[model samples]
Target: MRPLASLFKGWFLIRRDLSSSRRLFLTAVSFVLPLALWCLVSYVDWIWHPDIKLQLSSEREGNSTVFTAGDHISPGYYQEMVVATRAENTRLLASTPPPKSSKRANQKLLRQLAPVAISHDWLPYTEAQNDASIYHLWRDIATGTKIPTDPALTPENLDIVKQNWAQLAPLAADFSLASLPETPLLKLIPQGLPANPVYLPAPHEVWRSGWRDFKAVPPEGELSMTQRYQHSLRVILLGFFWACVVGVPIGILCGVFDFFSKLFEPFVDFFRYMPAPTFSTLLVAVLLAGDAPKIALVFIGTVFQMILVVSKTTRLLDPSLLEAAQTLGASPKQMLTRVVIPGILPNLYNDLRILLGWAWTWLVIAELIGVKSGLTEFIETQGRFRNFDRVFPVIILIGVTGFVTDQILSWLHGIIFPWTGRGNPIAQTFFRILFWPFRQISKLSDRAGTPT
Candidate 1:
C-alpha cells in the first residue's frame, strides 16, 4: 500500500510537471483533435471511411490480388469471395445439395463453408459454376488436410492423398492444391468440362519471382514513384519561391509607408474577401491567357493568398518605432532597411509559415484545375483511375511532408528572432496555461504586491 501510494504521488507530480511544461501540450491537443474527430466520424458510418483500411496486395503469375480490410471493398476485375452467413430463409430458397456442400457437422463450420457453395441463383467460387461437380470441386479445396482414422495423416501420407485427388488435376498440373480426395470426387466431372478453374491463392498466399527480360516489348509508360516525387518537389519549391518573392516585397512596401497602406487597404480587403480562385481566374486571364504561358495556373492560385498575408502583416507594423528611427536622423533608405525591415521581420516570417500551409492547400486546388505536377497532381491521377490504394499513401505523404516543413520553419523562426519568442501568442498562451497553477501558488507566496 505504501509503495502504491508513493507511485501515485510520483505520477501526480509528473502530471503537474507536464502541465507546466510548455506550448507543446496545446499543439499536441490541436493535432490530436483532428485525428480523433476523423476516427469518430469514420467509426460512425459517415460519408468518409476512416483511415483504418489496409490494402493487402499480392502478385501471382501475371495477375495481382488485392484484399481490403473492413467493409466496402471495391469491385475490380480481380476475383473475390465473401464469407458471410445465410439466414434460414436463404437456405431453403438456395436448396444447396449436401453432396455439393462443404459444410461439416458444426453449425459454425456450415456458415464458414456456405460462401463457397453453388445454388441455381448463387455461385460463390472465384468463377461461375454451371454444374454440381464444380461446387464439389470447390468443396474438395481443403484449406487443411483431413486427419484419417487409419493413418496418422503425416505430411508424407498427405502427399499420397493429394495424388489421388483428380478434381485437383488442374492444380496438380499447375502445382497448387496438394490435399487428397478420398470420396472419388473426380467421378462427378463432366465428360467435356472446360479447362479446370485456375486455382488462385488468397491475397495473403501469393509469391513473386525475379523478373525476366522480354525482347521487343511494346511501349508501356507511366510515372515511377521517384519521378512523381521529383515532380512534387519541383512544384512545392516553385510555390515557395514565388511566395517569398511576392510576399516579401508587398510586406516591405506596406511596412515602410502609411501612404501605400491607405492606397492598398481597400484593395487588400476586397481581395481577401474574394475567393483565392477569383484572383487566380483574373490573373490567369491576364498573365496566363497567352499561349505557352511560363507560369502555370497553380502558381497563380497559390501565390495570391500569400501576397494578402504579407500585405496584412506589413500594414500591422508599429508606426512609433518607425517615427523613432526617423527622429534619430536615420536616412529614408537606412530607416527602411535598418528599422522597418527588422521590426516587421518576425511577423513576416510568421506570415510565411501560415502562407506556406495555405500554399499547400492551394496547390491541391491548383492541381484540381491546371497544375501539371506536384503531390496534388498525383492525387488527381489516382482519383482518375480509382486506384485508392495508391491514393492513400500519397495523402499520408503530403501530411507528413507538411508537418515536417512546419516544424523546420518553426525551428528557423526560433533561431532568427529570439527576442520575439516572449510575444508569440501561441507560445505565450501555451506556457501561461501550462504553468497557471504554479503562478497561482507563487502569488500565494506574495503579500500585498511584495514577494515573500
Candidate 2:
C-alpha cells in the first residue's frame, strides 16, 4: 500500500511538472506576431506600389536577340585586353631594331610593351585591368602586343590565353567581329546595341505591358503571384524535408546512447561555430560537383543549422527518463520507442521551429551564390547594380516569407504537441493580445464541462 501510494504521488508530481498550456500558447503567439506584421506590410505594398515591373516582361516574345551582349561583357573585356597585349607584341617584333636570343627576344619583347594610357571613357579597359591585376596577369595579358614568341608563349601569357579560351568556349556560337559602315560616332551606332543594352528611359515607353498591377505580374514567363508563392513554398518545404532527413536519426542516436554523443559532439560543436555558407562550399566540393553554387548554398546552410538544433536538443534530454524506463523491464528498443522519443519530441519540434527561422537567414546567403532566381537572388542582383527600388521589394518578400514560415511552424507545434510547452515569463508580455482570446475560450470550455 505504501509503495503504491508513493507511485501515485510521483506520477502526480511528474504530471504537474510536465503540464503546460498557457505557456505553449504564449510561446506560439510570441513567434507569430512578427510574421503577421510582415505579411500585412507586404500585402499593403503590393496593393499600393503599381509602378514596378518584373524584368522578364520588358522583352518582346520570341525576341531572343534582345538579350544583351553585356551579359558576356566581363569575359569579353578580358579577351580584348589580351588581344591588345598580343597586338603590342606583334608591333615590337616588326620594329627595325631586333633583339638577341629566343629568351632575350621574349624579355625584350616584353620590355618594348609599355602601358597604354587609357582614357576616362574606357570602362571596359579599366574593368579588364582590374581583373588581370587581381589575377597577377595585368602586365602579361594587357601589355603583350609589344612582343613575339619563337619559343612559345610564357606561362603568364598561356594563363591569359587559357582564361580567354575557357570564357569563350561556352559561347562559341555567339562570337563575331563584323565591320560596320562609317558614320557619326553617336548616330552610326545602333540605338539598341545588343551588346551594351544601355537603359533608355523614354517618356512614352510603356511603364508595364499586359499587367496593370506590377505586384501581381510574374517576374518572368506567365508568372503570377500564385506561382511565386508556390515556388517560395516549395523551396522552404524541400529545405525542411532534407533537414529532417539528415537531422532526425542522428538526433535519436545522440539521445539514445552516451557513446554516439561523444563521437559527434566535437563535430557538432565545430560546425555550429562555422558559418552556414561554409557548409555550402564544402558540400559543393564533395557531393554535387555539378551543383550550381546557389543550390549548394541552400543545401549546406539548411542542413548545417538543422543538424545543430537536432543534436543539441537531443543532448539535453533528461537522463532520469531513460533510467526509469530501464527499471520498468523495458527492452532497449522499447525504451527508445516509448520513453526516450516522447520525452524528446517536444524539444525536437521546438528546435525545428527555431531552425526554420534560421533557414531564412541562410536563404539570402544561398541566393547570393550565383543563383539568378529567387527573392534573395533578385535583391542581391538589384542591390549590386544600385537599383534600390527593385531591391527593396525583394527584401520585403524575403522577410515576409520568413515570417510566414515561422508562424506555420509555431501553429504546427501548438496543434501537434500541446503538452510540450513550458512557460518563459518573457513571452507572456509580448503575447498578451494573442493570448486573451484563447484564455477566454479555455474559461468557457471549463464552465461548460463543469457539473452544476
Candidate 3:
C-alpha cells in the first residue's frame, strides 16, 4: 500500500509535470485501456455478442450471398440459412442427383472443410485448396481417427461428413477429379460462434486482415497503400503550406497595427462563421475537379481559423519587451521584425502545431469532395462496401500519422527552444546526439591548445 501510494503521489497537482516514467506509463495505459475494452467485448462469451461468426459455411442454390468462414450474420438469419441448406440437402437426396458438377466446381466445394481442418492442424494452410489432402482429412474425421476439438464440428455436420465420405470412398480412396462421383456430396451444416456485429471485428481478425491488405497486390490501375500514404501527406502539407504563406503575415500585421486590424478583422470574423464545406461545390466549379479543387477546399477550411489563431497569439506577447526596445532607440521596422516576431515565436510554434491538427481534420472531408483521393479515398471506398475491417486499418493509420507527427514536432519544439524547458526525455536525449559531433570537435581543439 505504501509503495503504491508513493507511486501515485502528486499525480493530481494542477498544471504540474509528472515524472518522465509516469508520463510514459500513463501514455501506454491510455492506448492499452481501449484495447482491453475491445478485447473484453470481443473475446468474452456471454457478453453482448449479438451476431454469429461462421466457421463452416455453404452456398444456397438460389441465394447470391455466398457465406465463407469468418462471415458474420444475425442469429435469426443464421437459423434461416441452416434451415435453407438442410432443405436443399433433403431435396438433393430425395430427387435424382443434379447433372454431375464439373471437377473444378466439386474441388472448390470440398475446400469448404479447409477452415475446419486447418484450425485442428489437420490441413496445411498453403494447401487449403488442395484436393488430395482434404479428402484424407474427411476420411480421418469420418472413421474416428482425427478428432477436431478446438472448433469441433456440429453434431449434424459430423453426420454429414460420414455420409459424404461413404459416397466418395467407393469412387476413389484418394482425391481424383476423374474418379469423382457424378452425384454431388452432402454439404456440411452451417455452424458458428456467437460474436459482435461485423463492424466490431476481433483484434486478431483486424491484425490478419490489415496485414493481408498491406501486403496485397492492388489490381492494375489501383493505387498501392504506400502511394495512398504519400498522397495524403502531400495534401495536408500543401494545404497547410498555403495557409501559412497567406495567413501568417496578415495575422501578424493585424496584431501589430490598428489600421490593418480594423480593415480586415471585421470581414475575416464574419467569413469565419460560414462553414468551409458550404463553398466546396463552388470551389469544385471554379477549380474544376482533380487535386486543385481538393487542395482549395482544405485551404478555405483552415486559413480563416489560422489567421484568427495566429493574430490572437501575436497580440498576447508581453508589452514590456517592446517598451524596452523603444527605450534602446530601435526603429519601427526593427522593433516589428526583431522584437514582436521573436517574442511571440515559441507560443506561435505551439499554435501552429495545433493548427496542423485542424488541417488534418479537414482531410477526410476535403478528399471526399471533387475527386476522391488519398488514404481517405480508400477508407471511403472500403466503408461504402461495408468492409469495416479494411476500413479500420486506414482509419487507424491516419490517426497514428497525425499523433506521431505532432509528437515529433513537439519534440523538435523543445530542442529548438531549450530555454522553454518543455520536451519529453527522449527528445532531450535526441537533442544531445544532434550536437555531439560539434561538442567532440570543441573538446579536441581545447586539448590541443592546452599546455602539454
TM-score of 3: 0.77
Leading candidate by TM-score: 3
Which residue pairs in model 1 clash with each other? 161-180
Residue-wise C-alpha lDDT for candidate 2, range 1-452, written one tens digit per residue = 99878545533444455336645865788878865654444335443232222211112223354321112223354344345545544554476454222332222222221112111111222232342222223223434532333213456544544444343334322322221111101000011112212222111121221122234434346445345445555565666667778778776786567787778756876776777676665655564442255444555566656665676776677878878888988999998789878878888887877777776676566644433345555455546754444445545556677778677667666445656564334454446567789989999999999999
- Segments in model 1 whose C-alpha atoms lie over 4 Å from true places: 1-220, 278-298, 371-373, 381-389, 421-452
Arrange candidates by TM-score, highest first: which order? Answer: 3, 1, 2
- Per-model TM-score versus the true fold: 0.51, 0.44, 0.77
Positional deviation of residue 36's Cα in model 1 after best superposition, in angstroms = 8.5
Better of 1 and 2 by TM-score: 1
- What clash count does candidate 2 reach? 10
lDDT of 3 by residue, 1-452 (tens): 99988976788889899899989999999999999989987899788899898889988777898888767899999999899889978987888636566666666778889988866556643467878899888899999898887579888989999998888888889888898776777788898889987468778766755776677677678888888889888888898889889888988998888888889888999998998888889988998888777777778888888788888888898888899999999999999999999888898888889988988888778888888898888888878766676788888888898899898888788887877877667877887999999999999999999998
Candidate 2 global CA lDDT score: 0.48
Candidate 1, residue 274: the lDDT equals: 56
Question: Candidate order by lDDT, highest to lowest?
Answer: 3, 2, 1
* lDDT of the candidates, in the order given: 0.47, 0.48, 0.83
Model 1 deviation from native, Cα RMSD in Å: 16.3
Q: Per-residue lDDT tens digits of candidate 1, residues 305-366?
A: 66666666766778787789889999999987898778778887877777677666666655
| Best of the two (2, 3) by TM-score | 3
